[model samples]
Target: MESKTTKKVTRGRPVCEIKQAEQKAKLIFSAKQLLNIKSYSQITIRDIASEASINSAMIKYYFGGKENLFVELIQSIADEQFSQFEDLGEHKKPVYLFIRRFGEILQSHPGIVHLLSEEVLNKTTPLARAFMAAFPARVSKFLPPLIQQETGISDTKKAKLAAFQLITLLVSPYILKTLRQQAWQIDDTEIQGEAWAKDLYRHFIYGLKESNTNEVES
Candidate 1:
């Protein structure tokens, strides 16, 4: 029962598993590197493989195709981001910190906005729908409390509306950067950074206070 051949086979299984995991991680890394320089449609399986210095066929073996690979990439990014946002609950200035952190994330991953537009907002494929159901839709539930905390807007409906508006304010600059740049020569640097975040926070707070005042008067 303690034959050397049995022990050899058992030990080999772990090595095999480790190698496969490394290959899969290589593919994912290659995909992310390519995505940074090129649009999703512009990237091919070979490009990722070449960037990774791995065999091209391994892409199909590991991720099935570019679509699934990108989905996994986005999912991984979302998981990290969601965890970071959850940690904001412990921050004293969660609202402003959230806005600044959100802006930095978008700026760092310039391709992510395009991927969202192409995959989730513009299409209703099963993968796209699943992505929305899994991440953004679920994350929406977490924002209203932050809104309520910052603005003292206790009404559930009003807090939810404020949350949606705040997110749109933060995301619009990135989503519309190309058009805004062409039309007004405005750049992302002007709309991002600590100064811009502080300005946004002040404006949002002012608007909420004005609304509360008007409601009291009415």
Candidate 2:
């Protein structure tokens, strides 16, 4: 149907394209699963490609290698996170429900805290510093003021601190997980663990009010 040179080039491109797409998908899936279990330093391009069943070299061809892949993964997660926030922002979700959602998000994306803790929050990497710089501004815009508006806390400082404490409560599970990995094993997402989290959430919320609020405490 075409000249020899043209046919060779045309056929080659499609094969390359298909291979590229497969490699990309493999890397993405592998990263997501591995991220849930290990720290970033423990993750390698070779490991990802091997897990994805592709040549390690293919990772470069498709995702521009490990750093870009990590950035892309963060962006994908941020997009999904913002979408969840948007959905919640539209509803008058109960305080404990909102707290539970924060925990659930962190639980499902355990790697976020691990990475953020190691890199940005820990001053371990310049890349983490860059990510952390914008994180507070972004989170502040949506969380604290929103909490104040919802709970009628006119004190801006208190509202912001409350929001941070709430996130800390949500994040406590991951912290516990990291600590326990050194010795004891704890599953913060388990029913017993979740009940404790709810109690803490309710306990903390009580302090944000004038006199009365949810008495549910851990």
Candidate 3:
């Protein structure tokens, strides 16, 4: 008697699905590279597609549109950085670690800093509003506790303020990169690496400690 023959079915992603994922990733990467070179208003969907060497329709199909793609790109970057802070609350030196990591991120993606600065200054675009709302909420949530731990500022509001101040100090140099180079002769190499981060951390901590001492004296 001839036995029945059975066929096994594979239970993984189909070839088309894998191809789609690769295409999407390429689009995202190309968008990021273009963002570093051009402003949001200046970059077009065709530009991203061309940069990725894919069809423009793919971007629309994958991300809905240029604006949505931009939002997704920024969201991905933010998620990556925030994920690194998962253990921040439990860190022995949260402030130092945070500063060092932040510096590294900015150095790695100076274009993101520039893009955010432009969006913030404009304050009229949907991207700007989305970023303003989302970014600060995350900062307020994770950073205040870390700031409290580091500075002994028991009040949440004060701790948040301190956190904001520290962020400002870390971000200002990057945002003012052109001005620093043109006027002050400070180049990117001098202002962006581990050495720069160390100096910023020391200066900020010293100033904060001095302020706390003055408050106690008063």
Candidate 4:
């Protein structure tokens, strides 16, 4: 981890090395927790610092500001959730990946659901737009025609929509779990987000199987 203090590297020395994830994850985790209690706009640098027991300046040093920090943490969750899409080139079946990754997002900072209000989901913010834009472009590193192969949806628009729908279906249980918590009637543990995501994927893939495809030949 970089020092709590950023130092001038003597003459040509590189800027202080980036902090290790273990050292830094605490701050992220802390900020995530605080974000749950209040909207991102209501939460301040002081809140995050107090929660994490670190200096306010650390927020600036690590993330530059709250907006950036929220974006980064959300991006981090997306990374964990989409890792299989990144690895398997998006052409691979999503079911196997959805279960594991859905579990990952659940286990890892599922708390962020508190901050991710429906207002934000409905209204397009620059940070959210930037996140949405950058994410699938990388996935498109593997998506585009794989989408074509899968759904026979060749138009770029349709393919992207398919990707978004598949991702949404996989991740919706996190939000549902949050809703269940708000309802306060059921055990969150009993919700089974991962299994549900896998089962939905199973149904989706089974339904998407084409009549003229090789499976039909068999």
Candidate 5:
């Protein structure tokens, strides 16, 4: 019972949406490639558009501006990393599971730690504030339970400290990747493999034992 024009418009919408999604993805990918070589401040719209092989105006059309695009890219990376954590508690060895999944993310997103350090940890820009607003709640909600389960820590403060230590242990390696390679010849693949995760879990759990026993006693 639809007119030809109405049917045509409905059919055209899906194709338009698909094209828009493709364009946005290209822009995002372009930004990511440029980010690997350049700092966030140094990457411009033209650079991204040139990388993407699209017109420069499309960057604004798709992402509003360069800053927002970068923030969204970082947010997407955080979401990808965080999504891997959901199944951690379900595993028998949650700490090992967490470390392995953490490695997977680092493998998939090389230089992600550097990007995060440059854009979020080292700055107080609007992009940093936006990312902080969106992600910290997710981290707070997810990490504490895993930490408590692994360490058997009943006190909130001690559990928090353990979580901080665990994160530091996981992230510091990647942050110091170059130094780790130069000093020890430990490549990223070795760190991102099951062998390293097992070792890290053993050391971390062993370290927790003294405190866990003391906490139970006192």
Candidate 6:
């Protein structure tokens, strides 16, 4: 019988590569955490490095600079948020469930809303402008398809309009938290939770269906 030879298979990533990847991830995570508590203008490379327990030079080496790091952070957040809506397309759940889950996500990660608001008000930097432009385009890409799927409304214009309305409803409470509490006696936590989600869903469905009926009649 001929001797059999077997090649050894590599099982996992190299230790150094794994460590390097982990270090990069730590930087990203630290940036996100700090952004949650402080605005972009206030956060520094040293602050992020301190938070991540890595050298500040590593941030410059890995991401080039603070602005680039922040832009990457915003991209990651937008990707995550848009991914949630993509799942809805596969399951085809009721629109109410989508609204409720969206509210829950916003409430859980209020930092994202705050960051978006800040970018809109302070559109002085290229990073801010890129983020502001990318976000709505991302939403428009995912939302109208989902609305069409749920409501069976084929009018692209109406679907887009409804999408804008739903987005406004979902985000307004968190964006205007202080004003909401003082003027409307409603807090962000309450507004972006299950109860408010359900109420908004009911009202939205009613309005959507009524509008569709009017469109068909006309």
Candidate with top lDDT is 3
Looking at model 4, which ten-residue stretch has the lowest summed lDDT? 11-20
Write one digit per residue (lDDT tens) for candidate 5, span 162-197.
Answer: 767877888888878789999989887778787888
Per-residue lDDT tens digits for candidate 3, residues 1-218, read: 99999866433222488788888788888988988878877889999999988878877778889988888888888887778888877878888888888788888876678677887666868777666655666876887788778777666776778889988887888888789899999888887667777788788777877777787889
> For each candidate, what is the lDDT?
0.78, 0.67, 0.79, 0.60, 0.76, 0.78
Worst 10 residues of 5 by lDDT: 6-15
- Judged by TM-score, which candidate is best? 1
Give the C-alpha miss distance for residue 108 in model 1, angstroms.
0.7
RMSD of each: 4.4, 5.4, 6.2, 7.8, 5.4, 8.0
State candidate 3's TM-score.
Answer: 0.85
Candidate 5 RMSD to the real structure: 5.4
lDDT of candidate 1 at residue 108, scale 0 to 100 = 88
How high is the lDDT of residue 69 in model 6? 84
Q: In model 4, which regions exceed 4 Å deviation?
A: 1-26, 36-42, 61-63, 76-84, 89-95, 134-159, 176-194, 210-218
Task: Using lDDT, rank the candidates from best to worst.
Answer: 3, 6, 1, 5, 2, 4
Look at candidate 1 and give me any clashing residue pairs: none
Q: What digit string (tens of lDDT, one per residue) describes model 1 on residues 49-121?
A: 8898887777776678778887788777777777778777777778888888888888888777766665567
List, residue by residue over 1-218, the lDDT tens digit for candidate 2: 87566334432223666766766766787887888889888999988977887777766766677877877677666666656665556666445556666666676787787787765564745456545543444666678767776677777887788888777766655766667555666655452346866687567766677422432231
TM-score of each: 0.86, 0.74, 0.85, 0.61, 0.82, 0.83
Instruction: Write down the lDDT that model 6 would get.
Output: 0.78
Find the 10 residues in a row with the least total lDDT in model 1.
6-15
lDDT tens digits by residue: candidate 4, 1-218: 87697866434222446543443576777777876666667778898878877767777776778778777777776676665555543436544554455455555554455444442466678656645554544654455445556555546775666556665664565666656666766565544556655676676656554522554569
Residues 100-209 of candidate 6: C-alpha lDDT, one tens digit per residue? 76776676665677677876555768786767765777777777777788888889999999989998988887888779899999855677567777789888878887
Candidates sorted on TM-score, descending: 1, 3, 6, 5, 2, 4
Query: Residue 156 lDDT in model 3?
Result: 74
After TM-score superposition, the amount by which residue 161's alpha carbon in candidate 5 deviates from its true location, in angstroms, is 1.3
